[model samples]
Every structure is written in C-alpha cells, then in structure tokens.
Target: MAWSEADAARNRELWTQTNADYTAGSAPAAWAREEMGWGIWQLPESQLRVFEGIDLEGLAVVELGCGTAYFSAWLAKRGAHPVGVDVTPAQLETARAMQEQFRLEFPLLEANAEETGLPDQSFDLALSEYGASIWCDPYRWIPEAARLLRPGGHLVFLRNSTLVILCSEDEVPAVERLVNPQFGMHRFEWPDGGVEFHLAHGEWIRLLREHGFEVEALHELQAPQDAQTHEAYDYVTADWGRKWPAEEIWRARKR
Candidate 1:
C-alpha cells in the first residue's frame, strides 16, 4: 500500500520506539534472540553458510539496514570488508557500539535504504535480510541497491512471503504478537505495533526485475532450528516442522 504522509508519520513514530528499545539494549524475547543463533528473525545463517562455501574473503560488501550489525559482524569475522547501513541512528549507534565492543572493523552508516548516501558501484554485494521490505518504497530501493552494486555483483535478501506456515498462536510469546498481525503474505508490522502496510510477493519479483537484477533463487525456508530452544524443539518441530516456512529468502545479481 502507498504510504500517506500520515502513514509516514506513524512509521516514524514506530521506528523511533524501536530504535529507543535498541538503544536501551532491550533484549529481544527468547524467540527473537533465538534467531541469532539459528538464522531466523532477520539473521541470515542459511545465506551465510552459502557464502562461506564460496570465496568472499576480499569482497566489498554492504548490509543494508544492518540493525545491530549482526550480519556485518559475521562477515567481518570472515575477513570481508563490510559496511552496515541503516536509516535509524539509534540502530547505527547500537551497531557501532557492538562493533567496537567486539573489535569488529566494519563501518556503520545511517541512511535510507531507498536512497543510501554511498557512491555508485560501491559494493560487490548488497545484502538485506528483512530490511528492504520495510522501506517506504521498495521499487526505489531496488534500483538503489543495483546502483550500489557493481556490474555482476549480487543482492541477497530475505522477505516476508504469502506461503508461510504459521506456528500455533499459543506457542509464540505474547509480546511478539504485537507485530504478528501485521506480518503475512499481505501485511507488515513495524516494531512498535503502531503501523501496518500491505506488501505482496509479486511486488518483490517485479521490483527486482525493474531494477535490473536477474533472479538467482527464491524459496521458502524451514522454521529456523535455533529459533526455538532445545527444550521447545521437539514440540515446535512436531507442530511447525511440516508447515512453518519461517520466511522467504531471495538471491539476485545485478545485470
């Protein structure tokens, strides 16, 4: 859905609330943090595993909307020169602090995903896990992503999709439900539960095509194993294993 000025205002407020939480180092609930270990939530373990199998030791990479710089941190650990960009300064600050704390050398920048301040063809790979979808205009951002990526560069992203298999409403924690209703094949929720938007799968493919990306791969991923703790694994796997596609992952290359 198109965002009205009022919608933008509401989104700003919601993001502000989320950034405040990040600044406060508010720990994501067990499930949210669980993704960190297992690659659910916004973490991209599956993609990272794929990256590890290849040679990325010297590539210039950018993680768009890199909240907390988790992925950037991961890449840096692997010897890639990575930059983390985000629209929220609070998030950037948190990411920067984490980098410093971990002695990670990655750079963090504050910028909009649709219009990053970086120069053209500045990166060999632009990765966005659960970030680009939330932008005000993904169509605009897709080309920006392409522009930032050099010719033959790649864009790896994860998006919420329509074909998701849901966990039992009872299994998920209560606070997470605050944003649950906003997410699906059709809708999205911001951090504060203050705004919702309609987003669809076709829009993602069309956006990539319009921006000069050749689709490489797109598919649903199984529920992240670490997203549920060991104790809950049996129950979660039994209930959601067959059904739950935790999210969608997309891979594309600049053409």
Candidate 2:
C-alpha cells in the first residue's frame, strides 16, 4: 500500500525522535568513522566495495536519508560533488555538525527522499545505506531515484532482506521465528508509530524495472558464526545472520 500523509507524518516523527535520541550520545560519530557496512553485521566495504568499478571523481552524487552525511562526506573525500538529503531537521543538523567537525563542505538538504525537489537527471549516482530505500516506500522513491539519475547513472542501496524483516519485530533485539508472511508483506508498522517497508525479491526486481532501472547486481550479505555482533544494532544477532541473509545490497542503473 502507498504510504498516506498520516504515515509520512508518523515516520517523520519517529525519525525525529530517533535522531534526538542518538544525538544524545557520541557513538554515532565514532561509528561513522568506522568501516562502511550494510547492516548489523558491519561487513567491511573495503572487501565488498560497491563503487569499486565506478569512477566517482567529480561526479554529481546524492545520498538519500543521509542521517549524518558520513557516507556523503566520504564520497566528497573521493572527489565526488555530494549532496545529502533527509527529512529530519535534527538529522540534518547532525550532518551539518559532522561537516564542520570533519572540515568538509557539502550541501545537506532537509527534504523527503520520495519527493526531493532536486532537478531531474541532475545526479550521476545516487546512494543510500540503510536509508531511504528501507524506510520510504520503494514505489515512490524508486521512481524518484530514476528521475534524479542521468541515463546510465547508478543507484546503489542497502537494506534489510525480506527474510530479516519477516523474522524481526519492532523494539525487539532478537531475530526469532518468522512473525509475518513473506508474500505480499510490504509494509511493517511499528508500535512506536514508525512505518518501514520491505518487498519480496521478485517484487523489487519488477519495481526497479518499472522505474527505468536495469538490475545490475543483488547481493545478500551474510555474516560468519564467529563474526562479532555489532553492539549498536541490537535487533540482529551474528548467529542468526550466519544462518540466514540479514541484509541485501542492490546495484542498479538507470536505463
């Protein structure tokens, strides 16, 4: 189902609260400096870098749902002209603070990912790591991303797999048995008024195709049983990730 305005408001409120809560601590800054990872497993991007073949130097890139703009800043450091877009002002504030702290200059826009006012075909690449693609409705954001990208431009995002989404519950740290059916499970409502999104693998392919995206790669990230669990992400366990895919990365190109 498409998210209503009420759902948008609720999600905004939820993220606002979340940003405020995280801002009270210093962990986010420290974690931002750590290796780039997909999810709780925190698999190092150095070994599985998504932008490996793509040249980012002087490219126009945009990061959706860039909470602290760390990834965008990283892109800027690589010589990409980066812009960070987010809905929550608090989060953008955090991004601005990080910009100052790191002495990097980048624009951070307070805008919803689903309807960012960025010009059409304005970006050479778009990125989201555990960001807009996971929280916003893909039906909306996928097309928005297509609109933003130049032809042949790439869109890469990381999100929780449907397997993980099915097995988890809001505010619960452990990944137990499946709590929801796989088929037709698109929206997950949290008790705290937050709404998240997920889709079956085939559904994602269809959606991307419909939005003028050519599927390039789909990676299901798994962790080893001995891999250390990320203390910050309480929802997923190493054992569970070892047994099942916890996160997925999608690499697509605007066709």
Candidate 3:
C-alpha cells in the first residue's frame, strides 16, 4: 500500500476507536447549528472573520476530511450545498446520525482526502478544519483540492502552526524552545500510531501558487480568552497558546 493508503487504513482503526469520545464532547452532539468555529479551540468565526465578504449560500462546498461533519451540517443550514468526504466509515456513521437528529442533511463520502475520486471543478469552496489539513500530505491533497474546484473557487483549512509542530514531537505538548529543525519538514509520525503533515509558511504559499491558487490570507489563531479546556487537545497550554499561535487558518482561491 502507498503511504496515504496506509494512513487511511490506520485512520479507520484509530477513528473507529475514538469516534465515541468525540461524539461525547461538543462534536456531533452539542455543536450549535447556527454557529461556526475553527480548530480544537472552537474560536468563533464571527470574531476571526475568515469569510468576511464571501457569500456561502447556494455554493457547492466540499469538506476534505470532515470527520463527523458538523461543519457540513452548519453549511447546509446556511443554504450551501456541502458534501463531506472522510476516510473513516465510523466517522461518517456518526455524521449520518447527526443529520437525522438535526434535520440537516447532506451527502457524505468515504474516501481518502488525497484522492477523493470526485469529479473535477465541481466545487465553489473546499474546506477542512483540522481534518485533511493535518492528516493528509499537502503535496498530494492540495492538488486534489485544486482539481476539485472551479476557477475562482476558495480553499480554506485549519491546522497546527509549523512552529508548534517544530516545537514538539509525536503526542507531546509544545515546549518553550524549538526542539526540531525546520528545514525540509514534511511528514510526522507519532509513537502512539498516527501520522501528520506540516509545512513552512513559505512552502505553503509556493505550493498554492504552483497549483493555480491565489494565496488570500493566513490567520494565526490565538486561543480565545474564554476558550474551554479540551482534554483531547493538550498539545498547547492556554498560556502558551495565548502568547503564540498554535493553529492557523489558510485561505486561498483558485485562479
């Protein structure tokens, strides 16, 4: 199997085991239908204004790694047509259950984010919130996203900052000093059995441009003052997160 295929297989197992824990938290259950947030901090979109001038209604949106797909449900409620794609069937199962419970329905596909097997130029916006952004290889999945979008379509995603990844390794919390070298950073494997991808900001800009995307903006996410404690995400402490960005949102447009 290819690296991504192996990652997909591992994801199926890891997510299948942890999906219930997600459902227990503010995931598919307590997430507000009207509100939209990004990352584990759940920072308010209104405050961040990631979509300041973009109209969402009536657009075809594809969420790359929508594990449980609460973001898709939120988009559906806002009148946008959203299709969620994920590798784990267990995650999609929970998403399907939420669709019925919330009365907000959208299509969900079980596929690798790196190659969704969907038609090209079919989406107006592509989104991922700590989903494909971190889990999939940027070198492959980004081109896939570009292929899946029409000219002028947008690509938005949230992932950990390169700084955080360089500061820490595996499942460990970020330290005060840089523990890893930044040169040629790409793939990361955790000792606990999982994989992730992080790239430098300069690399990201170049990648977006090379793939016919116009770099729009990069939002370095500061943890909200009232950000609730999340047991699942302990990679950054509230104090450290408040001082430096632990996560970021990248917004780009197909050109």
Candidates 1 and 3, the one with greater lDDT: 3
Model 3 misplaced stretches (Cα beyond 4 Å): 226-229
Q: lDDT order of candidates, best first?
A: 3, 2, 1
> What is the descending TM-score order?
3, 2, 1
Worst 10 residues of 2 by lDDT: 23-32
Clashing pairs in 2: none
What lDDT does the true structure give each of the candidates?
0.60, 0.82, 0.86
Best by lDDT: 3
Candidate 3, 1-255: lDDT as tens digits: 898899878867877777866653556554464678677677778888998777989989999989888888887887899999999888888888787777778899999999999999999999998789988999999999999999999999999999988889566678889988888999887775778889988899999999999988999988878776468788888777888899999999999
The runs of at least 3 residues in candidate 1 whose Cα sits more than 4 Å from the true structure, single-residue gaps closed, are: 1-12, 19-48, 52-54, 165-199, 224-241
Reference-based TM-score, model 1: 0.71
TM-score to true structure, per model: 0.71, 0.91, 0.95
- On residues 1-255, what C-alpha lDDT tens digit does candidate 1 reach at each position? 445344545555555677675433642232123223333433445554534334578889988767776766666666678888877676677676666666666777776666777999989889886565454456466788888999888888765443331222343422212233424334344343543333555666777888888888766666544545324223234234335554566788888
Please provide, for model 2 over 1-255, each residue's C-alpha lDDT reduced to its tens digit, 9 standing for 90 to 100.
445456667777887888777742543464356566556666677877777789989999989988877788777877899999988787788777777777888898988898999999999999998778888888888989999999999999999888888888778754668887898988888777778889999999999999898988888898966787777665787888888888889999998
Best model number under TM-score = 3
> What lDDT score goes with residue 246 in model 2?
85
Clashes of each: 0, 0, 0
